[model samples]
Target: MENVTLSEIKRTPELLKQVESVPFKLEKGKRYLFVGCGSSYNLGYIAAEMLNKNGYEADVVTGGKIVALGDFPEADVAFFISRTGESTETVLAAKALKKRGIYTISIVCAKDAELSKTCEENIELPFADEESVVMTGSFSTILYMILRGIKRYSIDGIEGFLGKSFEYVDRLELKKFSHFVFLGFDELYGLAKESALKVQEMALQWVEFHEPLDYRHGPKATLTEKTLVVMYSKDTAYEVELAKELKQMGAGVVYIGKEGDIEIPYQDGFETPVRILPVQYLAYKKAVSLGLNPDKPKNLTKSVKL
Candidate 1:
C-alpha cells in the first residue's frame, strides 16, 4: 500500500506538467461532462463538483448513461476517468463522444489502455495495475491528483497536502469500528459515497453513506450504539446541526471537518477533500487487521468486463 501511494505521489509533478501543456480551450458557455465507472465514477463526481465550483459548468454521469443517452449537450471538453482505462462502458462512452466531435480528456492510470487511445488527451498516474479487486490507494491518489489540477495549486502545495494526509493515515487506528456510516452534503456528497464504498469494498463490511440532513428523514432508524457515523461537515450551519443531532441519538459520530462545535482532530475543515482520507485509510487498515485482503474484495474484480 505504501509503495502504491508513494509511486503515485512521486508522479504528481509529471502529471501536472502534462496536463498544463495540453492544448485545449475551456470556454465559459461550454458544458463539461465527467464519466467513469465505480470508484472512478465517484472521482468524476468530485471532479464535476470542483469544476463547477471553479466557475465551469459541469455535470457528472455514469459511463452507461453516456452510451445509452446518445446525443449529449455540446461541450468544450469531457473528462473521462477509468483506473484501468479498460472499463467497457467508459470506452464505449469515449468512442460515442468522439463520434460526435466532442474533445475527450481521460484521467486514467493505464497510459496504454484502449480508452486512452480514444481520448484526445489523458492524465495518467503511477497507481496502475492494482493487485486487489477493490481500489484503495489508486482511487484516492487519482482523485487527489485531479483535485490538485482543478484547484490549479502548485506542486509544492500538493506535496505538502499529501504529506500531511499520509501522516494522518499513519496515526489512525481503524480496527475499532465494527460498522461505519459516511455522511456529507453538496460537494462532499460524492466524498461520502466514496468513503462508504471504501469501507465496504476494503473492509468487507456493510457500510452506509448518506446526506447529513437526509439521514434524519429515514436512514436514522438503522442507527444504534454500535454504528459509527463518519460525518463530513461542510461550511453550512445546517450540517453542524445535523451532526449534533446524530451525536445526541447515541450514534458514534466522527466529524470530518471543523465546521461545527463538536470537532475531531482529523477534521481539517471542508475546503479540501483530503479530510476524508483518514476514514478511507482506517477502513483499509481495519480490513487488513481483520485478516482480509482489501486488494481483492470478495465477489469483485479490478475491472468489470461487461
Candidate 2:
C-alpha cells in the first residue's frame, strides 16, 4: 500500500498547477504579518522571508506567541495559516488581529475552517487538503501560492526534480544514521527547520536545524558518525567549505545546491517550496525502513486544539 504521506508529497506539483490559477496577489507598500503553528508556522516564516527579500516588508509570529504575549507586530494586513484551520492559537490570533483593526486573511487547505470564520477574509485551497496527520503537500502549495504573488515562477522540470530527488534519498542507507542536521540561511533557514521537523515527526529521529556557519560556532561539537547533515547551500565558497568540514567530522552529508550531492539549483530562496520535496520523501522512507507509519505520526493529531 502506498503511504498517504507519500501520495500527498507526490501530488504537490499538480497542486501547484491548480493553485497557480487562483489569482492570489499581495499589495505593495503594506506591512504584512503571518501567523500559524507547527508546519503552518514554518510556512509563514518562509513566506515572510521571501517577501522581505523581494522589496516587501513582512514579519512572522507564531500563533502561540501572539496569544500569549497579547502583543503583535504592526501590520497593515495579517495572514493566518492553518491546514485544518481549527488550530486554537491561530484562530485566536486572527481574532486578536481583527480586534485591532488589522485586516486578517485565513489561508487554509480546508473549506470553511474555524480560522476562516475568525478572520476578516479567507483564501481557502480545499484542493490541497491532506488526509495524513502530518502536513505534506499543503505546506508547499500554500508557500507557492504566496510566492506566486511576487512572481509567477514555475519550477522548470518539477516532475523530473521530484523523481531524481526521491531516488537520491532512497539510495541512502537509512539505518546507518539516527541524527539529522539541516543547515541553510534566511528563507532556506526556514526550509531547513521544516526539513528537520519532517525527519523528527515521521522518522522519530533526533533532528536539528541551524544556519550553516553557526554550526561551526559550537554545534559541531556533537557531530558523530551517526549524524547526517543536510545542507541547503547558496553555493557560496564558505558554505561549500563548511560541507567539507562536516563530512570530515564523520557526519554523512547531503548537500543540495548548484553543485551538490543532489543538485537542485538555488533560486534566491523562491526554490524553497520545491527544495523541500526530497526531505519529505526522506522522512517517509526513513519511517518505512524503521517499520513506522509516516501517515500517523506518534502522539500527534492533525489539528492542535488549545
Candidate 3:
C-alpha cells in the first residue's frame, strides 16, 4: 500500500504531461454540471469555482445526492468524474442525466469502464489510474488536465515546490496534534476539504475544513496544542492575522501561500493543485507515526462498487 501511494505521488509530474493530452474540450458560454463521488466531487467543486471565475457557468453536485434524491442541477452539459470508473452512483448519475437528454461527459482513469460507457462523451485518463484506496496523484493530475484543457496551467517550478513542501512536512510533529483544521475559500475551500479527507482517510485523524474567516465563528474553540491548523491562505492580511492568533493560542499552524510555509504563489486559483502536496505528506507521515499502514487505511477499497 505504501508503495502504491508513494509511487503515484512521485509520478505526478509525468502524469500531468500525459493527462494534458486527454481529448476533451469545453464550449465557451455553455453551462456545465460536474458530478462525482467523494474526492472526485471535491475536485468538481474546485473546477466549478475556477470555471465560474473565468466567465463560465459551472455547478458541482455529488453523485450520491443525485442517486439518493434525484438532485441533479440544470445545465447544458454534465460531466461525471470517477477515478475507477466503476462507482455505481456515478455511473447511474450519468445514465440518468443522459436519459434526460443532457449531453453527458465521463472522466475516468480507466478506458471502457462502466461509467465511461454510460456517457455520451468519455475523457478516459488511463495513465493516471491508481491502485491505492486513497487518491494521491490522480486527483491533482485530473484536475490539472481539466484546467489545462480550459486554459494552459503550467507547473513550471513543481520540483522545487515539492521539495520545500516535504521539508516542511517532515519537520511537523504529527502525533502531537490530535485534531486538524484546513481553511481556505472558493477553489481553495474545495482543496481544504480534500486535504481534510486525506488526513482522515490516511491517518484516521480528526479533521475539519472551513473558509478562512469562518473558522473563527465556532471552530476556533477547539484550538489547542493538540490541534494543527493548516491555512491555505490567499495572502490576505486577515488570514495572516488569524494564523498568528492561532499560533499564539497554542495551535500548530502551517500556512500555505506566498511567503508562508509551503510558499505557493496566489495565481487566481491556478496553484490549487500544488497546495495539496504538504498535507498529503503530513497524512502519510502521521499514519507512519501511529504505526498504521496508510496504504490499507482501516476499511477502504480502491473503488466503491456500490
CA lDDT for candidate 1? 0.69
Q: Candidate 2 lDDT, tens digit per residue, 1-306?
A: 888999999999899889888988987899999999999999999999999999999999999999999988999999999999999999999988899999999999999898888888889999999999999899999999999999887888889889999889989987999999999999999999999999999999999999999999998888999999999999999999999988988899999999788888888888888999989999999999999999999999999987
What are the TM-scores, per candidate, against the unseen true structure? Answer: 0.80, 0.99, 0.97
Best by lDDT: 2
RMSD of each: 4.2, 0.8, 1.2
Show model 2 residue runs off by greater than 4 Å: none
In model 1, the clashing pairs are 132-295, 133-295
Leading candidate by TM-score = 2
For 204-237, candidate 1 gives per-residue lDDT tens digits of 8878888888888898888877777887776467
TM-score of 1: 0.80
When sorted by lDDT, best at the front, the candidate numbers are 2, 3, 1
TM-score rank order:
2, 3, 1
Q: Alpha carbon lDDT of residue 13, candidate 2? A: 89
